[model samples]
Target: MAKTFERGISSIPGYKELTENMSIQDLPLPSELIIPLRQHIGAPNRRLVSVGERVKAGQIIGDSDAAISAPVHTGLSGVVREIGSRMTQTGQMEDCVVIEVDPEQEKVKYTADDVSHLTKEEIVQRIKAAGIVGMGGAGFPTHIKITPQTKIEYLVLNGCECEPYLTCDHRLMLEYADEMIAGARILSRVLDNAKVIFGIEVNKQDAIDLLKEKLKNEERMEVVPLDVKYPQGAEKQLIYATTGRSVPPGKLPAEVAVVVQNVATAKAVADAVIYRKPLTERIVTLTGDAAVQPGNYRVFVGTTLAHLINSTGGLKPDVGKIIMGGPMTGWAQKSLEAPIVKACGGVIALTREQLAAAQEYYACVRCGKCVDHCPMALYPNYIGMYAELGKYKQAQEWGALDCFECGICAYVCPSRRPLIEFIRRSKRA
Candidate 1:
């Protein structure tokens, strides 16, 4: 049966019972970790520490000359074992600092006595010091994202966990309501004074209620339940759905005078500004039919999939595929050797049935279902076919790079063709 969700808006159609919030597995910690410096979108970090150097939790190990780049820090107490190029999910080789965990390394959490008494500028500095970045899959430096050339009147707190089988954002909204609001407020200040509007899909009522309760006195932060829809949390889409202003194509949210931040990213901001914590750990949701234990987890960066899977009581024998992030924009891992990086949203262990179901792609029948579901109103079949034909320049002429690769067209494709995958190959992003 084709699933349809009612998210409260007409254009935001399809999907209803968004199930996530599992907490079943606790994988063993890795003996060694590999923290990559080029986790964000900008220039990759340059290694500052050499092999055999000791580092404590939160100590800077990588630095960059680029202004847009942020430094990478040690996630655990360890000695730098080696530094070499490693395979990344994007299929590139990059420098990776190997650290052998001491196991007894102390955890240093960011702490603040009170945020109410803190000045706005002070909060922004703390956010910068903590090395926060957009947690919504784009590892863009969070501090830089907040700083605009002009003032912003509206701040959209992304609560829409739009991707299927990923509920980390939903769980964060439900469980960390207070922190989310506090973070949202700090982000608003970073924008030179803007009232925050927290946007969640209507499907996450529990998260909405919890946030509402926590925000009882927060008139500055308004929670609006968005119509549940894929890509609702997307920068352009969320801005449009919340403020009814589309971010001009090939432009940024700031072009519309809006700043969008994910709920999880907001919480990370709070941790940096209010709590004085640097970016280290994040919430990861593990699910799928092969998942013996499924739910949300608070995990440190650099944790390996093998370690996480073992914690979840080991992947089911039928586990045939593992995906990182949400089903929509998520990638099927080439192997279990990959470690969780800063941009990872979820780790899904798929049952053999689920894997087999999506194993094959047939020729498109020209049904036009993909075009109907594309939020960008793009012609996915055309895009896919063009890309497969190796016409990169022609794909760009068709606005291929601007597709945002949200995966909606592929999701709704009846032929199950890899529309977005082709776009990805063409864009080479």
Candidate 2:
């Protein structure tokens, strides 16, 4: 048995029902899309097209020569209406390309004349061209991750969609199992045929069984069942659960000779390599009681939150907050105008009642629940306390930066303390 990470919530109510019997639905294209230039972590891309310039679907709209960045593409054939700044989901203002969708437009289909003759270098090139990133929300470039400095020995595909109220990955595993498997094969080859393991939570037994059956003949790849817990899909946690390899703090996965990519990203790699397609869209889960129709959607990148809500019969009048990504780590959006980016996995519009009740912070009674529930095994309560006292260096020493903000500390806190928020502030400081 694998030694799983200590301190994780076993379950959260109201999330499991959203994953049952859910199939993907195609979202209607938006009238206009706001494509941000700085979707990835590193330097933002420069605009390649100006206002009034016509662009085809999958056409590169922004790119940079920087090594750490990836290109950004438009997902629809349209005219560039404006080039301006817009607020991204991360609360950063970035240059955005506003494109007005052409009423009668045909999407470009990618088809590689030959796929079997492709080399590893060719595969990397295609992935870079496709603008594939860690679709699980990190937004790191996929090509760069696959090309590591150390000799990679393991390539882990994360299928543990452990976040509450988010089922996009689960649906992808069920719907695009074969494509994902092919992607794993391609990625393994890119890593010089490293051992590939698909790590999924046991709750997704259907996905596990399907992938296992599909990968029986493939010697280098296998699916491993994981414990169903919050933050189980996190790269480090998944790495430890699947491979029993612990990545040292403040180091990349390459330090341990491991390459971790999300299941959706793998499928994207396969699509990019085999069909020469760029990542213009992805599966997004629009769920919660606020959603009139809760289901998975093949949403085009840059589509507005309002367009998605309207397509799904709009939000209930009693909706309280709209979050992008999962409940534990997702960002709360003030408006529905925010456009979907490459890293966005799911949009959760929670009802007022479903939302957690607001609470005033109380002095920590030195109860160790926060520490007890911290997956990183850091003293979250102390970090929060040090941060509140403006002793940021002390908080850093307590491993505030290592906190992935899984929200478990806050979730289990009896004092209703905002430990996660304090830790985030300390990291920023």
Candidate 3:
């Protein structure tokens, strides 16, 4: 049986065929890289290198003593060109370390480590030193997530790449299943060998079948096929769909004895623990209708969107919008200069025809479509209205902060109201 959350728009097109079948390819290093120091959600990292300083690949360039933050590393050997503020994918100006790529680069060698005798704290320290975070767009540090104070009973692996036009996680599941499973086992060991359940969407039947076959002999791991729906991969929704448990509002999944980690994040963990590798690169889906060559590329962090788009064949003449991540919840890029951070999974180039309907929006008519489809079951209409009037406190009273910004409200709204934008404003306020 395919499990799903109570309510969310299922009619949205996935558009995943563009690159779902494509194998991951390595992207050529760009001339320059703009690596942001504060890629995770917690405290910002202070620069550790000065301009004109030469650094090696996988070297920590930025770090913080804050418990909630992760360090930043350079993916390529280069000379520090500048350290200044730049606009990141989040649409905010953050401090960045600019590195000019060297014509000749040094390669970092990784060797597999024996984890049989490793302790939980050692595993967590390795993960933290590797700078691994939630690669499924949340950008939360993984070390803190795995070290919850409550006893965890379930470890949910999010393989439901529900957002349209994004197939990086699906590809990771298909190509790196063993690595992901190994990483999951590592995480489980840290969590006292909690039962690992993989919640994959039905749309990726191949992944589900493969994982099921692989895990049939494993007693502590199982695979659950999830109903195809937007935001089905969300932490709370995936937990409910897999375990029939609900995480209360303003509460973490740990409250319900559950912990959810993205499939890509698991893969990174395996690399970090087994091979003692740092997270300096990730598989990014360079896709969409307007892309000349739509495929998945293993891109280094700090690579610019312009370099990626130009390297993989530039966009079509009719391209109207370029977004970082999936269309439903991704951020629209105003300038191609924005660099790819750890959490960036896809770069979509939509044609003018595709974005035509998104040009204008009107006042909400209270059609209740947003309420009917919101996965969180919060009142987006009232929140948007209150936020539009700058009544952020009222918006909070209507459950603005609880929103994960899934964009289902704006997607199903009859009046085309930018409910996600308004909700974001309210949260910021």
Candidate 4:
């Protein structure tokens, strides 16, 4: 039987048919790239190159001495044109390195290494040097995540692309299964040959079956089919569903002796460990009702939303909004000028008719729907109410910080309250 976390919306539409079957396509290099200096959640990176300096593809352009930060590399050979602040997919102004891509560009060369003789520290160093972060949206540095301080028992490979209108991870699992499996093995080897479990949602039956067949003869590896549920791919939720282990609030999966890595992140690990390739590009699902050519494209990091849309024959006339990631948790873009960062996985262009029309929200009716469906088991109603009333302490007391902002509370609210916005404010406070 497929496993699942408690109390999450299981009936939500996936809308994955728009791009799930589409094979990964390579997006042509754009004329310019706006690489953000800080794409991860840790310490900010300092610019390493100045304007007018020429750099090659895969060359590091920004880095930080902080142990928690990941390096930023250019995806195309180009001349540094500007280093200034620009609105990123996060809807916040961040320092970006703008590069004018050279017309005559050569593919970045990567040297392959024999993994049989490489030490665990060497493997992690390669991943760090490759600038790989969690491609599943958290954007945590992968090297830091794989090298946990505690002894890890399970290396869970998250293949559950649960978000509606997103299929990047799904396509990767279907098309790059070999690389992903190899990466999972490499990760396991680093963690002292920890048991590897591929946690895939049942919606992706083909992926589960393929991985299972591939790993039938492999040792210490198995694929567990999971129930189709929102936030099923979250690290904590996935760990619980797969291993029957609950990660306490204000703690990480490491404390529970488990580490989850996204399927795409695992593929990048394989690329870094075997080919010494840096993380410069990722597969992004450009899909939705308003998209003219919806499919999965392997887009270079720092490519703008406008470029992606224009590449796909542009959006339909009735396009109402463009979101950077998935509909549930992605940021709605105010401008197409915002560039893609490392963690971006999907670009959804929805028609006005497809979008929920904005309306005035009333006070919480104290209904238990939000609490009933909340996967984190947090009281979103009280948190939103207190946060709306300018009581941050009260909101915090109601478990505002414990909320992962999955948006289930807002989706289930009968009063149409923006619980996520309120929770964000509370968390900020």
Best-performing candidate as measured by TM-score: 3
lDDT of 1 by residue, 1-429 (tens): 112232212443332223354532344667888777778888888898999999898887887777787777776888999999876655567788889989786757555767777676677667766777788898898768888887788999988887777887877787777788878877887786697888887777788778778777877777787765677778888888777787777888888899988888888888777767778778888778788877788777778777777866888889888888877788888877677787787888777886677889999999988777777777888888889899878877777887887877877787889888899888983
Comparison by lDDT, 1 against 2, better one: 2
CA lDDT of 240 in candidate 4?
92
In candidate 3, what are the lDDT values of residues 244-332, reduced to their tens digit? 99999889999999999999999999999999888999999999889999999999999999999999989999999899988888999
TM-score versus the correct structure, for each prediction: 0.92, 0.96, 0.99, 0.98
RMSD of 4: 1.1
- Put the candidates in TM-score order, highest first: 3, 4, 2, 1
Off by over 4 Å in 3: none
List RMSD in Å for every model shown: 3.4, 1.5, 0.9, 1.1
- Put down candidate 4 lDDT per residue, 1-429, tens digits, no spaces: 999988888988889998888999987779999999998989999999999999999899999999999999998998999999999987889999999999888966777777899999999999999898999999999999989889999999999988998999999999999999989999999999999999999989999999999999987999999999998988889999999999988999999999999999999999989998888899999999999999999998999999998987999999988899878888999989999888999999999987665456888888899999998888899999999999999999989988888898998888889989999999999
Model 4's alpha-carbon lDDT is 0.91
Clashes by residue pair, model 4? none
State the lDDT of candidate 2 residue by residue for 395-423, as single tens digits.
Answer: 99999888999998888888888887798
TM-score of 2: 0.96
- Count of backbone collisions within predicted model 3: 0
Superposed by TM-score, candidate 1 places the C-alpha of residue 313 at a distance from the truth, in angstroms, of 1.0
Give the top-scoring candidate (lDDT).
3
